[model samples]
Target: MGIGEGEPHPAGSGSSSVEVVDVLRRGELVVLGRIPSASNATLVCDVVLDDVELRCVYKPVRGEVPLWDFPDGTLAGREVASYLISDALGWGVIPETVLRDGPVGFGMVQRWVDTPDNTDRPHPSAPSELPDGRVDLVDLCPPGAVPVGYRAVLRAFDSIGEPVVLVHADDPRLQRMAVLDVILNNADRKGGHVLEGLDGGVYGIDHGICLHSEDKLRTVLWGWAGETVPAHLVADLADLARRLESPDDDLRSDLAEHITGDEIDALALRTLVIAETTAMPLPPGHRPIPWPPF
Candidate 1:
């Protein structure tokens, strides 16, 4: 139930909520003291039972719905997939608890993850340094530690790995992740949210904006356009694409029980979107970045 040093939390595993959004149906929790609604969807608090070491996420009634719109109370089905993936890959996924009764109908509560070394703590989307230059301040989602960062992840998918982000056209792993994001319609791929594990793995966060009926990818990675696809890597993506559409692949939605029929359709559509356009130019008039910074 608790995480210790040198061990990563398991995927699709985390504390669950004892309540839903309807109870507070008309309001929010004010007991979490001076919580900020400005930076990161969460404002740091001691809502969950734990010391400064436990990872905790605060939901402000209005903050919960975005994590995965599952009618308000039930844990998000889509997010659990991310949890499973992150856990399987080995990293923090920030387990959640919802507090209800507000605009969005739910808020989150979970453990607090440590900020990576030589860097500031991270918000759900952007990683930022603390005010006093100390390490423990509530910070934004931090960026990856390039060169040394993702070394493990890159090595895992080495046959298809490219030296850069945007130009990694042939990277099957990234392509698969991209496909997953497209299917889920994830919009919080901001630099800080994506982490390069100390063990060289790749992990991401912020599932609130996922599973939309449209393309919502808005991250700050990918160095350029028209990046070339490595043929071998493309073969891997083609395999995943094929596997995704296969109805027999129960494992596809297994880890995450919150997924719906429509969400599945959205996932298939993601592959189509990419297949139709290899370059996949940014759609017109979309800022791609979420407002309010939270």
Candidate 2:
């Protein structure tokens, strides 16, 4: 969880903290403590921020082969991946990379996911025996996905009187969140990508694939294929759209720069769909399942 693996070292680890701009990305850097790579990337620390409490997940200059089958180096889509899940969950779950002081310019800071009460990786011999109806928060899929094995969890939600509308239709808050997520090009919202937090909250992690300026809405939520968007969310979508189009919209511009031109069009289209509550598919040629398939 140290800095300066890639970027020039401004100060050594033992140096007194300096201005985040000079040392961190901005003010409000909460050193939540350091951690090690649990899944992918070489990130070894977790930090929190002011306001949105964006978890700064700094992607260090380290990774292994076989992830996404890249076979070498690291995958380039992690930032967008975290964006998708954070938006879907209606909470801030992005790579702490917003900070500029960390080595590699601060994309994600590792937050420690304490060992679960039941911390056994699913048996390799009988993987499906993870229990068909079990409520294990983290599905034991190889490549991490947070949304894939949601049905079992959804069933538990149903037991608690939560409705089981398609992933996109279950919650209006989630629908609105999706609007923001799509605009951000969050790519890794797979079933295992999401983390059910200790605070009764769901926080999405793994952001190396975020902010890509593309129209990538692949997740299990597409089950509600033709559902209409709710009205309250439509108004919210309008507000966000207006803000994104504004000249002062730093977030939008940041995204527009990273993603593809067609991706920007996809973001605009998704926003319009949410604003109008269009009962249509999320995007043409868009995947219906989150990646890192569970």
Candidate 3:
């Protein structure tokens, strides 16, 4: 069906992960609308199976904008790869994402997360601030007024030259996401990408520019820098490292389809470093945080 032609489908609720993946992989996609502010063409769609329908985000490869640092049309694959890694790590940080054919073309389709403040189809001008005092991983505060459970990352001025401090929550869920970003070499982890689901789960999204072989880790989640990685997370990293060691390993083989062998090797190396060192690495490179840090 044509874009904007269908009634908004309430996103399916309480589906198992396997069911979500199946619907995303085999369902018929009907475009509801476009996420106008997205750098790439991002469509909010309804994926319909025989008796189930779910809202999902579809990023078609044909709509990808070429980037100098990343190869063309690979962003969709990278998104799926990020989901694979998150699934393997048993973190569920990223939503259920799959690369599949849609109305536009082949692309990455991810289950839509229902957040407390967002509607079925989010608009370009949707409020960035979470309602009900729900804390975001990254936030801005007046200089020297950092919240009790937050870590100050950068001190700067806002557009009107008002002093502000960039900070992130000290919650462990966000810390796990930071570690995942390190292993994925995620180039963009803007504050807006972190979502607080209505189901009380914290999720990270927009992982199109991840899994690069280089040290392109740019994020607003520097709160845990220089701290020892939590023992439970380190053990998970160690498990991931072991899975990536063998050529016949399922995770390694699955990753090789989306990213290069060198990139997968780099992922393995990063996982091993964190698993062994058990410490969060300090920000590397001149620009450690992404521009506009949201």
Candidate 4:
């Protein structure tokens, strides 16, 4: 049968979460092209179902290069697990994802989110140090441009040696995603992995290097460090901790199918610590942010 043989709207259309999962699990995958910049081999594809056409990214097991830290042939599985964690917490930060046999072999297939234009929003201008020996906003306005009190948390230089301010994690969407990264123990939460959808939803992706048993939570979202975690978020973490320890929980069983038992236990431990502290984690000091920020 031809791809998307019976669709009026694209893949998601108005489908429920269950329907979306079903389509991702059983739809026809048509590879459109390769995403060359990804560390692992990644493909942009169309998931064609009887009544929907969904854009997706496909990462096959065979395409993964060996990593000394994480087990071989398990990155795709981690990607699916990340989606499950995001869903369980009701954060809605990760796109719908599933694992199935594709053209290359068993791998991860995730819904592709489209980023909307954010030209009207404030963006980074430049960075400078403060009198207190801390780095923060120097100025945001361009020459005579109107100032909006945008604080610069991090700083980097542009292609021609001009400075560019970095994103402040104070943005609500970003703050949520950053907390999710801490829960997942994401070791590679790059700026590019954060997506702003056309519907104004923000999502985090590229979770292949996450959920380690060790304390490897390196990221670019340090703006909330040393701050109190909101009480509601603490409650959510408590719920997650309970779910991780429950024997009959579906999410626990699902994660076991993809990752090691030790890693799951580590997740439980991490959840408890986060809830107990109720504060953003402090940097480990010495090279916490990933290189090539974007």
Candidate 5:
């Protein structure tokens, strides 16, 4: 069956946020198949609750690949934490996600996003002759020929030793996602993780390795580094900072369930720093970008 078949309700399809959360929380889950490309055991599933049915990605805690830096089996909770942070900021960059019991055990279930088909277009990592025709978030173009409305991030040689430049669209939607990544301390923002939904929404997914205590903001979206954060986003960040400062704030209490107290404090600090500066950050550390960017 195709992704989200059988009249699956697409996210942002006029369903109230509360209603969507209720369906995901109460739905009976059936594993459809495994997404082989994922490093973890990511399962595509059909979630049903009475007449409402939705397609979702399920990542059971038992299926998580252990990481030395992060505590074991916490990736599922991190995924949910990332969604909470995104929702609190009112950016809606991440799809609706919740942590609950699934077929395999406790895991994260996120609404599946349907991206635009770009199979015929050149892969984002390979140099594209038609830069203007690019539909994805990241692209490679001939050096010194960056497409209009695109920002050049790096100039390097391709596999055949031909010079090329890495670039991403200078889109407001993408810019907002970049800011959200900064707030979440997202360690992996590969080009492939960015999606343009059919509903005219730009989304970021695969947030299993995010919201660490340290500064590990690796991504391919450094196109706007050192630039001023948009005024609206700055305002939102300021609001989020205020909420995080409250000990009994619902957002803070919800996030506390997933991440450690230190990690939450780190999150609050990151939000405050950006809100105060209102400037986009230049990448820190030697390994600022993720390998195989697409």
Candidate 6:
């Protein structure tokens, strides 16, 4: 969803990343406005710390709608877990997110990111209808709209029977975020959840339906599907795999508070498999891509 109306909130108010994280973990939250969106109830709010205001997204556990596939009341925790994984990889692909008590109860709060205007921003689930009404670009555009070395990862036709090209498999940020989704077993990585910061950082959000033990991965980021994984990415996965296996690892301990032990085991297994194969595995005959791939 597009950002709510009002002045945009700057993310870095001269506070170090550590200090910002601390505020998200302990500050008092004041509701700014409701961001209307499809799937979940997300709120735009201010985290107050010693009179300084930090904008954030607040997702209360009580606001979560029940899903048949996912365990109830765990979405908020999963969001924080996703952030932890991103930090561990040193990818900074997810905005700083933390779990803390809010006005309603415990929930997930993530630092707000600054994105460009609607017309220029790209969404994973949104398609841009060409003026001719013949083609719809799903997460891509004409050659001129993107930079060189951008791979035409997907090709398809719109409803009006026109051809289209889905490019940008070479975007390093997107590539890393896609790998993060796989490791989390993210079941709903919609196009709209990808946000771009003013500083040029790409951030992935809405990870409520992730980290389940079951194989319910669904996303629009299959441009690199079945491609040989890069060595550096594999090394990151290897590190996560080793950490998940260690009994004394704090990450595992932290994750246990949010997900089932079996789910944690499944996450570890996924990391090991991805590292060993060194390739992005294709979906096992199930519906792989999300509908209306943006």
Give one digit per residue, the lDDT tens place, for model 4 in 1-294.
Answer: 244435435754356667778878999898877877788989887787767777788999999999999999999999999899989998889999999999878899998776543223222122222245322212222233323433344666666776666654356777888788898999988777887777677888899989999988888787788788888888989999999999899989999998889999999998889999998888887667776666
- Stretches > 4 Å off in candidate 1: 1-75, 83-180, 229-233, 253-256, 275-277, 292-294
**Total clashing pairs for each candidate:** 33, 51, 0, 3, 0, 6
Q: Candidate 2: lDDT of 173?
A: 33
67 Cα displacement, candidate 1 (Å): 9.0
Better of 4 and 6 by TM-score: 4
Which residue ranges in model 6 land beyond 4 Å of their true spot?
1-14, 118-148, 152-169
Candidate 5: regions farther than 4 A off? 1-12, 118-133
> Could you estimate the TM-score for every candidate?
0.49, 0.53, 0.93, 0.85, 0.90, 0.83
Give me the displacement of residue 23 in model 3, in angstroms. 0.3
- On a 0 to 1 TM-score scale, where does candidate 1 land against the true structure? 0.49
Mark the regions of model 2 whose C-alpha exceeds 4 Å error after superposition. 1-40, 46-56, 61-97, 101-107, 110-181, 210-215, 254-266, 278-287, 290-292
Highest TM-score: give the candidate number.
3
lDDT of 5 by residue, 256-280 (tens): 9999989999999999999999999
Residue 191 in model 3: lDDT: 90
> Candidate 5: what lDDT?
0.86
Q: What lDDT score is found at residue 221 in candidate 3?
A: 93
**Cα lDDT of model 3 by residue, 99-189, tens digit:** 9988988999999888766764356345555566655668889987888999999888899999999999888888999999999999999
Rank order (by TM-score, best first):
3, 5, 4, 6, 2, 1
RMSD of each: 11.2, 10.5, 3.3, 7.1, 4.2, 5.6
What lDDT does the true structure give each of the candidates? Answer: 0.41, 0.42, 0.88, 0.79, 0.86, 0.78
Higher-ranked by lDDT: 2 or 6: 6
Winner by lDDT? 3
